[model samples]
Target chain A: MQFLSIFHEINGDLKVVEKELEKYVLTQEPELTLAAGHLLKAGGKRIRPAFALLAGKFYRYDFEKILPLAVALEIIHMASLVHDDVVDASMTRRGHPTVKAKWGNRVSLHAGDYLSAVALKLISQYQDKRVLKVLSRVTVEMCRGEIQQISASFDAEQNLRDYLYRIKRKTALLISASCELGAVVTEAPEKIVRALTRYGYHVGMAFQITDDILDMISDEKVLGKPIGGDLRQGIITLPVIYALKHSQEKEHLRELVTKQVKSEEEVQEIIRLIKDSGAIKYSFDMANIYLNKAKKELNRLPDVKTKKTFKKLTSFIGERSF
Target chain B: MQFLSIFHEINGDLKVVEKELEKYVLTQEPELTLAAGHLLKAGGKRIRPAFALLAGKFYRYDFEKILPLAVALEIIHMASLVHDDVVDASMTRRGHPTVKAKWGNRVSLHAGDYLSAVALKLISQYQDKRVLKVLSRVTVEMCRGEIQQISASFDAEQNLRDYLYRIKRKTALLISASCELGAVVTEAPEKIVRALTRYGYHVGMAFQITDDILDMISDEKVLGKPIGGDLRQGIITLPVIYALKHSQEKEHLRELVTKQVKSEEEVQEIIRLIKDSGAIKYSFDMANIYLNKAKKELNRLPDVKTKKTFKKLTSFIGERSF
Candidate 1:
């Protein structure tokens, strides 16, 4: 099935979020407007906002009441990505020039700053301090995750635990907050909110795992950037960590991947070596475990059509190859 | 009277804010805690937080209720300064190595990001949404101000209006919010809130103008950084702008200040030329206008002791040479 199928029911609502996102990012400064709006135009899957919108539907769902939060979740995601690019000194994202690429580091830094403040503005409109609290805590963790990743980069001795902790904060925490805050905004009951939060957390972990795997094997065209990009940058994702610990060519993998600079050929060779090992299967099984845990969380929810959609989303994540 | 006397009444209260600031910055990541706490250890005036605390005293002021906000205000100031150092590539602040200098730009960037999130967390303690709203809006404007300064840097053509707008957002807005949020969190009457906010705004403007003037003539040892640092960076301030337009050697001044780099001799010469041009007096006049306007706003408030402090603050800002 197409990945679009999971969000098909809410595509119209997502479109509203997309439109409002443009307006929310507009500012008095033209250059700022351009830089802050740059990533939104480039576009992502809108998965976090979709997760939020879907989670909000589990209770007294009002689209207008929930729209600001949905938009804010996506903006938070975009804000982090903008700063991430600055940290990485990345020149491109989504096959287009990144904000950091067009503007200098200073503009990109303030653009990210402006976006984060904008997100706060949107979340503040909800009047529930819980939403702001959850986001603030999660955003802090997200920043810590980014700092950890920077510190952990190119370290051959980093363990599986290190990789998990990093990804948990870097990706899973915000995704989990999306679901939790969505339920909170909709006034979902305690049980429902907890279930959805755990579900989102598990799905987020699996999603990031799948992304790590795809970074090795996905067509560069499909991924919209180079394959092994993470490896080239010494991020040492799940598969690489697994290969470093368990693969037949562990020594060579460690030496090559831990190198400060990797040639294109070196990156390709490392990718090939990891693929030939069982790391891909090992990583897939791990992701499936998370998918199963995510499905178990839906079992706690009331038998609504949304639950069925949740099942399909998990299944899609399980079988997703790209 | 000394600058310390302005906050003498709140010395103990400011101490609480200082202690809480240390605890607020602690994270699971020790390096992050260190980087975020570095500036806190290197003391500042605690002026923004003191403004909030003092402003909280006008009506129904509860010390415990406002303490979180006071600490949060200082954290916000530190966060901006940390990010500002990155934007300026400044290696030192407050006569010490900056976060950007001790750690890399990436660490400093994430450190700033983490501090901002912590500020949001602190503000979330209030059930009232207005505090968040005011903060979010002010923070966004602050970012826009920073970006404007970057874009305006080194451009010889910027006018007084450009400098005014930039400083309004860059300095005045947050200081205004500091006083405004204190009034808000204390549930002060709307009339009083408006008075304190305007008071903060005008005082902030004068405060920045005074800093700009001092940047040209203050002792390097007293100012804690090199004199003429702003002029050297191509940031045209009010006094420099005045000199650029009115000095006998306007062309020479412009040529020297606008150069991408300057030797110590050129910096000294540029400072001497601007000081001799009557630009210092012109800039001082602008600052006094703001201070006088700030004092007038206090007349609308109740005859509380805090109002008297506000008056003295304006006076101190007017005449403080250091």
Candidate 2:
């Protein structure tokens, strides 16, 4: 059950999205094409598009109408990753060189802006105001979340609520928007749209928590980057937050986490301590809560097949490694 | 007359836009507020908004309905400047510290992104799809123009077509969109909207040419920046393009222009060579052509007062020193 294969039924629609992305990003500047194309080539799960397609199934499911929105959602996701790499100056993502690593931060910054502009343009073709409103609000919140991440970095007093708001804006809202947008564009009933949106929010939260947990405990090879990458960047995720409050080595962990510099050995030590503090289990428990809530929303939908697929998707998110 | 006072009749409306900017950019992060506020304090002409307001006057003027659009256009302009400052690594603008100077490039980068997202969200409230289409198209062209500028920087082979298209995409299209969006929103006929768009396009071209000219010849205290700023950043502008073609010292100028690094003396010498070549006069001549064309577009409009104001605005664009 690979993530890409999970959307096997909608693979034809996903291919259209892939083609549209290439057509839009292809420009006169060869270097720009290369930089902008780097992330597009590094295939992701297409989770946002998949969610949109699935959510559309409960209603009319006009693939042609949904195509632009699907592509726009994916581009927005890609744009955020490019900007995130610029801020962290991360050279590699998912085992591929980032735009920043290849073309420098200046080009990476503009490429991200270009992709966002392209996404906005694509969405502009839609006749509905709700689609634009949903996407733009999500974009604004994501920016606030990014700024908050920068300011809150290395703050020893970082709390659960701060982390929750940041991750929700950064991840959940966009995912939620994808489902809401797909449903809206297909003329879904209001009740069904709200249910799908709630499903997306809970699933997105569960997905991000799983990602943070894996960053601490997963192998570097499996994670596609270094271990404790978030810790190295002073990103204070859930495990670190929980461990800070309850770990036996709480004082030592804080000292290591708050340090301006960390060697490979220090990162290894920090990861080890976080793993032993029961924070991993605690994070999973919280994720299970979200996953269950996500499935509960699927119960409100009409189609048995789509509902089953969503439940399976929720389970996969709760346990995904990469 | 000062640029601000040029729009004396619209001062109260501009006040609302200024207040709205403060409201939208004021986030939870104090650092973000400061970075986003830096350029607002620097206070360039609200040229784009003025163009929009005047364009709207040709038919029906609904200030309440048009307010969001006016603010969005201004925000788009400001966003581009913040991004431009980041790319140029500029320390000051209009005699005030840039966002990049006060808060690092990372913060400045996100602040630009925040502003763009806010602008897009503001436009989302519009019932008309044409507004989004025009603005988003302008945004994409600007990004392409920026990428082209990067690719063409410091190249000895740069030509007039490259220079014209770059300036048009970077400066003219947004201004054109400002006018077009205003007209479209206010229920203007297509022909009048096209005329206003042409007016904006020509005025914007003249405005950027004059700005480039001022960058070379104006006092640092008045220009609010050092001379040869564009050359130092490898941004080949209109005068440099003109001088590269016809200057007696063409070979020497090309040699200096294409160099990886330049001294202050070299910059001053390059400026002198360009000035001696009459390229400044040549650029102003071209600007005058655009100014005349811009005024011609106004003959199609109805209101005598607004048309006179637009003509006066065109002249101001052609001759402004700062």
Candidate 3:
């Protein structure tokens, strides 16, 4: 809700994006339309699109020009979530049943593929080769990050470097591109584009770190899923990697995690151990580090209302609770 | 082996595409590299890239300009096959274990996704907006076709119209785009682009119909897959659709097919019934109809060596045994 206030000036543009997104999700087939519409209906913060809009605001803003890029970015994010649910075997996302949960993995796979292709189709209208190239590169990196995450699942030996690199590709690059593409499409100066891209990269890192922290400490009621959901799926996030390196109960935690956590009781016990291990504070501290770096990048841009809003967004990411 | 002779003139360009494809499949992660490499090394006919090359040859051929598009087309085709195996629960392709069979479905899904992204990234190097637009549209249609195929699977009520529509999206569109993109990249005359696209479309339809016939009739060793594979997987193709419409044993065949074919004997019995119903000949006749249409399109182009090669390729599709 706080993120909504950041969009007060651009609320009209956001509405147009929402309408365009709804229109894009409508497919000829009833089942596909339903599957794609499911996620579009279960909304999020629309952070990526908002970021794209804000970046455009730094220049002469035109909603029509920015609309397609913003919609495409959000669709790409949504497609990744669909596929992520399949890969994670997640039953729920954002307090709602995932595509995989309602229609089996096969349908989910094709749905995800469809959404991704739709994103490309929408952006193709822009005719900016740079935007297409950046988007294509980001897509490849995001998939590589996912593939790496899967291969590294439950490996307690993974270091901070690996964790940082994974999150950078999985979460940061797309967000970075969102900012860069917005500025590039709006014909902003190269320096401004670079600054905005750096800001997005840092903010994205903090955002994902907070998400990882929430998976460990947030309640099922608040988070829409069980705590340690990632652990149950064998996904070792930043906190878990930190806990593995520094926890006093490293041996017991390793034993519980190296093997699958089958029981709910076992999952809760592991959650408790991770919380007691000081990993949460370490993750928050790490997130703040990135947030501060994001603010520094924002300072490089000229003083404007949009600049303040961008700074507010970084802080918002740092403090977001579910 | 017969297809190799068809590539005799463009052999050097095809080699470049092969190398480009190999380069694109290489990744930093050992497991991903291996999974993707496995499929790339398994070897396809490279028919999509060959089509692109031959189309370009009709105009002023520039191997450099055509190489990226050709490689991208083949990668797209390869990506679909990887995902298709997972969707079909197939164990082998061309007598080689599939990515899903070698690695689990999760890994195969990511690998397929990665390859698709790579294809997009490869084409991004070419600064042609039309190329990007056409490729994106084709990718969306291809995914839609796959989704429709899944939803229609095991449904006995689907008609020939549905079957033709699905294959046009699944097989024909990308192949059609390959030809169109080839001509477009070369800045060929608009009339030539239209002719090549028509030729590709007709050729693609015939190619898939031939594939369907092979699934029902070819030897496992020769086809590199079990006979009646489409039926076993509950995929009703043109031949099956024809038999369902006209066979004297329609009632019994419908009963056996509507239920799962749980036994090898049942599969064999259904195969025999469909064969005796003359569906194979009807399917071949249908394929020839499209083949003739394709040759008609080629005739619109000027008399050139490449035009003759294109005609020969269509004939090869009509007569290819494996």
Candidate 4:
């Protein structure tokens, strides 16, 4: 909510986008409508759509022209989340039952697919080929990253570079594409587009790192999910990677993670090891590095009110606690 | 093999599509390449691409221009199959282990999604918004149909219309889209495009009915899967619907289908009831009606050499023993 406050000036446009998203979610099929509504009702930060709208502000801002693209990006994000929960066998998301949990994996899979197809259909209405190309490429990369993550799971041998590459594709690439697409759809200057894209990349990296930190340290009530959920599922995030590389108890940590931990006590023990290993500080420093790079890229953009909003968004990303 | 040989005149073009499909399947990720390769290697008739190319022949045909569309359609088909197997929990397709069977559901899900994204990216190379629009709409419909099928599984209350609508979206729409896309991409006259699309729709309906019939009666070795596969999975196909409607043992049949049949004998008993119900003849006649309709639509096109080939393809669909 604090992050979304940055869009106070454009609240009406955001409301329109929210309505458009709701409109798109209505399908002829009842089950699909229910599944989509469930996810939409769970609510999100709508960060991708916000980035798209913010990027459009740098150029000529027409809310109607950008509304479809914004809605499409949000749908894509929601679609991915539905499938991600299935892949992770997760029970809850953001304090709510997942689509997979509520409707079952089979329904969740098709629902996710339906939402993605809807996104493509909506985006196809636009004439810009580049926007479609970017979104398509990013979608493919995101899937590739997911496949990589699945294959790499429980493999304690993975290095920092592998982790970074996976996160770049899984998280950063889509956010960057969201920023790039906003500019491309609005036909912003090439320089401004490139700068926003870079800014998005850095911000996304920082954003994911911050998320990893939250997964480690945040309370379940605040985080909206159990802490250390990623580690429990054998998903190695930045803190885990750093702890594995630099901690003296690396072998013990690997042993605990490489095999399934059957008890809650074991999971807590692993979390304690990760925290005491100095990995949290290292991860925060890495996120700060990306945040600085993001701020630098924002300096390249022209002097506009939206530029300040972009910077504020980046800070919000950096300072977000949960 | 006999059906594919009908493409003798366009053999070179078909080969180009095959090679392009192979090229697209190659990926930097080993597991994805392997999973996609497994599905591709366990081949189908390539009927959808053939429909696309045949539709292309009505206009000034360019093999190169039509290849990507053909390949994209095939990839979309393959991707759906990967996901479908997961949904049905099927063990084999075409005498080979399914992606889900070999790689687990998680990998299969992501692999299916990756292939879909690749199809979109490849199609985006063409500037035709109509092609994107058709593909996107068809993909959405296909997902909707799957969700409907799942939600309506073992539904004794489903009518003939419900069955037809499901198959139209699940099987026929893509085939229809293939033919329509081929004509659209080749810049065929609107009259010819509409005719081919109608032809594809009828043929696709017939194809799915034939497939449903085959699922009931075909030999395991010949069909590359166990008979009664769809019934076991509670997928209420045309034959099953017909059987439930006309069989004197309708109550018993419904009882057997609505509950989990735990043994081979129970499945075989249900098959016997369906066969004795004269559902086989009803299904074949229903398929022939569509085949005749498809032939009628083909006659609306110009009497090009490809017209004869299209007629032969329709007969092959109707007459396929396996």
Candidate 5:
């Protein structure tokens, strides 16, 4: 096998899996087909499915077994995005108009349901009962996360522990399940499956922490949406929470939250305060901590090029726009 | 062995199932828990799940095997109700405030997601692959039916064939699957499974037809809601369709629909016209047809007391006023 570097050749298995996703997402609704198409075309990184395929390589990688899990995970992710658009009242996703903006909330909601139903249907193809149980539990956890987030909006004192738990349920659990179930479906060793699950949990925590930080600092052009949209909506994310704790301007920040800020200028001003208060850097440090932990989990795996690539991914997450 | 009069004996089993339902409807959020509880406490007849358990007894009465499927079907039914309240923008369900009205549309949507997730999770417990496949497909069809109904709303010329298909997806498919899968989980023979499936389909169709007829003639005091709610929302049910086909005052009815009548007086007038035009009787006749069909399917079942109660249920559907 080639060494894990940018110089290494990409696996043909991933290419086939990607091709299957493109085909699968195409065959959804006909009336809302275009809206479902819009969601698929919105350009997710497909990171979860990638983790699934990589984990699959450790086992007897049967395309039939691995592909359904990958597709199901991706579809679950897509459904969440559709509902996220509704929750955020977001007009665009990944630089394109969202289903809600294009077709209205009703259509978007139904499209999301259709996507979820399709995922559940696809997962039934697997004979492994444990895999189905994992998927079912993940879906429940994800919904509970969404519910928690909805109810917790604007609660400045919600604490880091609750925030972490929410994100773990919302983002990390599904991603962790992605890796673990990928191994289980492919019949990987129990040790490797457990290790990959740990890796996924930490990596996903890092990924979300980075995303939260990026929301406060990234360029709008690169982010494909306005920066600090989360803060504007009174979502007290990690960076905001950190800033609130340490800043001299805590009263002013709370005041701004109570009285909704309307303009992009005000939003940017808040973002500046958050960044200047060292909240973004603090968040970055926390993300790196998780990345380091994720890297350590891979030590349980054998000395292989794929393991190295997994390490590279951890590093990439840590260094991403630091 | 008791002959076919065993439907009422299911009350104890239903009470046991309802207690479990209360346990499952619990939530971390008090407001949502209470709102969902309102629907749960509205005291529905629990016909779908009861049918599943009763059918299960025909082979081997293992409530343990049947309980999950029964609860799952009811949860799915409740999820549909939550979403339907949002789509209809209604404020009440079964004489209590709906989740949408109490918690707003966002929470209502998420709560529906939570309910559906619970249903799917319970379903995943069964080791039988066939059961999983049937339940998942039924969910997909249910979502599709909702989409079709949303799109077809207020289309006065919408085909009767389309209407029947919509009811099949929205109501009958899950009910039929509950019976069929209940048998499958118990390892019941193919012929009994087929017969139970048919029984569920016919009963479900009759149920919807009764709902349509009751919309025209039942009192709000008895029905626990305003009569003509469907017509008020511009849902052209079987009675309305029949009235439009045969009534000389069809143009007047269309004008009333366009007027968007809201007052109880206007609702009563529409109800009177529907009743006077023989549309109510026509709808009742249609319900009787399905009731007879359901009875015919029951004839294939073994001669037992539970089966007799099943027959009584068909007659009950035909004769029940509200």
Candidate 6:
């Protein structure tokens, strides 16, 4: 599998990128700085920055330009994660206590606001108005996606199209913007920018779909949280939708999710039922479809070291059990 | 009083501006929309928009250009208020339940994000790069201000200079930007823009200092919140700082504040001590210094209708108690 192969190369860039992220996400307040460091130390896939750097390689391959954008994307991602932890009331992230859990919700929220402002300020140094414009708009879209999710939780009437749109905003826009913005700031041609954008969009879609599948089927050690947490929160992912279509137990599961559970056993039963219904496999198959499409989009770009890594990412998403 | 004389004109503009705020702030989510409506309906002086409009009148008084900038300023103000409420864990604002109080912290935080995004998007439509740059920087500065306040809270050793810097960010940047941006978009003369910016800066400093005094001395009916709320939260305002400089009674009050009171009566006693110590008058005197400075800045501009209103605003701050 290209997954391990590509991961090795992506790791080579990690130290350099990680240094830039630490430098930029910092604050003047020592407490906040430490809080931010604690959060950043929590391991992430660094997916946005990887894509940003790969896309930049297609143009001038300048780390000077790419590093800031990379750092900015990661900062933006980190900021959103901070707020998301608050919204979800999540205690542990990546097997460690989340910022909100450790410090408190107020500090977590302020830290997120701090990171976001710092991201905008860092990008403003680019003097590239387009980067600011895109970053600002993507930020707004991500927030709108959160609002949509909050408003539409557990509505069985919600369809796949709505789910797709939500993920597009919540997950894909920043990734796509990262790729496109990387190209734009490097003064890449319009066609190259479009190709990179399409590649990011499909890859982002596949990435999120795999995430949904993992939430349903992966081990807690791998996922770093309880399986079916999304379901417990009344977030109906693709697997649940698929399971509902086939199971005679659908009505009971729906009822459990729609109302607050009185006991842990009830939640366990719902998770067990969803797994037995083959919904996890169905969602994985759907994700594979997007992965194939994402790979196809990458074929239009020239063969390069980064493109090889981008190719490997498609397979990584498809094969990722965690 | 000029406030009485200008009341009708200001009220007319505020009514229109408040309606615009409602149109934008109201998410389709019924609960959130209701909470926003309550905050909007609980009315205050719409100073940001007024400054924008008055500044725009210096060159071209077209509401078409000015109104958007005005609304953008107000949106930024409202967004900051939402975030501020989250930071403070505030339960009441403007004599009503805050968004956080009614809808929870997550909803309020997301609502603030939405409002900020809306403001930036609206400002992007102006097609003036300089205006966009200035507005974006101000938004970042405003965030910096919030970070400063969050850092300063409960830090008994915070200096007056740091406090001044914090308030300039927390409160003054938006008001100053409102005036400067309004002028820039209208293509006003350089001198006019500079005058409006300085005027707005001084006026904003005065406004925040007055707010600090009112938090100690104003009644709940007038303040729209419990008196001594800042003290309860361990925020050392100008009045508290001034009082801390004098009197053994001030030491006792400071001790009470540091001890964390459990009863409203304890809070009341502290408030009485601050009032009896002449701290409120001392803060008012400091505010007058800023007001006089604001008036001096306005003198640089030739006598015009807008400049006259600007002068009136300086006086209005000195006499807002009426």
Off by over 4 Å in 3: A87-103, B87-103
Model 1 scores a C-alpha lDDT of: 0.84
Stretches of candidate 6 exceeding 4 Å from the true structure: A1-14, A87-103, A126-128, A154-157, A259-267, A302-305, B1-19, B29-32, B60-62, B87-103, B126-129, B154-157
Off by over 4 Å in 2: A87-103, B87-103
Q: List the residue pairs that clash in candidate 4.
A: none
Question: Over the stretch A151-234, how does candidate 5's per-residue lDDT look in tens digits?
Answer: 677677788988897889889988899889888998889998999899999999998899888887887887787777787665
lDDT of 3 by residue, A34-66 (tens): 667778877787888988999998887777788
> Which lDDT tens digits does candidate 2 get at residues B49-86?
87788788888888887889998998988888777656
What's the distance in Å from true for residue A293, model 5?
A: 1.3
- TM-score value, chain A, candidate 3: 0.93
lDDT of 4 by residue, B107-161 (tens): 7788889999999988998887889999999999999888988888868899899
Q: What is the C-alpha lDDT of each candidate?
A: 0.84, 0.83, 0.83, 0.84, 0.76, 0.74
Q: Cα deviation of B133 in candidate 2 (Å)?
A: 0.3
Clashes per candidate (backbone, < 3 Å): 0, 0, 0, 0, 8, 0
Give the C-alpha miss distance for residue B308 in model 4, angstroms. 0.2
Q: Ten-residue segment with the worst summed lDDT in candidate 4 chain B? A: B87-96
Better-scoring candidate (DockQ), 2 or 3 = 2
DockQ ranking of the models: 4, 1, 2, 3, 5, 6
> DockQ of each candidate's interface versus the true one?
0.55, 0.54, 0.52, 0.57, 0.43, 0.38
Q: Choose the strongest candidate by DockQ.
A: 4
lDDT of 6 by residue, B238-293 (tens): 87776666645866776776653336777788777777778788888989999998
Let me know the TM-score candidate 6 reaches against the reference structure: 0.89
Query: Across residues A68-103, which tens digit of lDDT does each residue of candidate 1 receive?
Result: 999998888888877765632222332333434333
Candidate 6: docking tier: acceptable
Considering TM-score, which of the candidate structures 3 and 5 is the better prediction for this target?
A: 3
Candidate rank order under lDDT: 4, 1, 2, 3, 5, 6
**Proportion of native contacts present in model 6:** 0.32
Worst 10 residues of 5 chain A by lDDT: A1-10
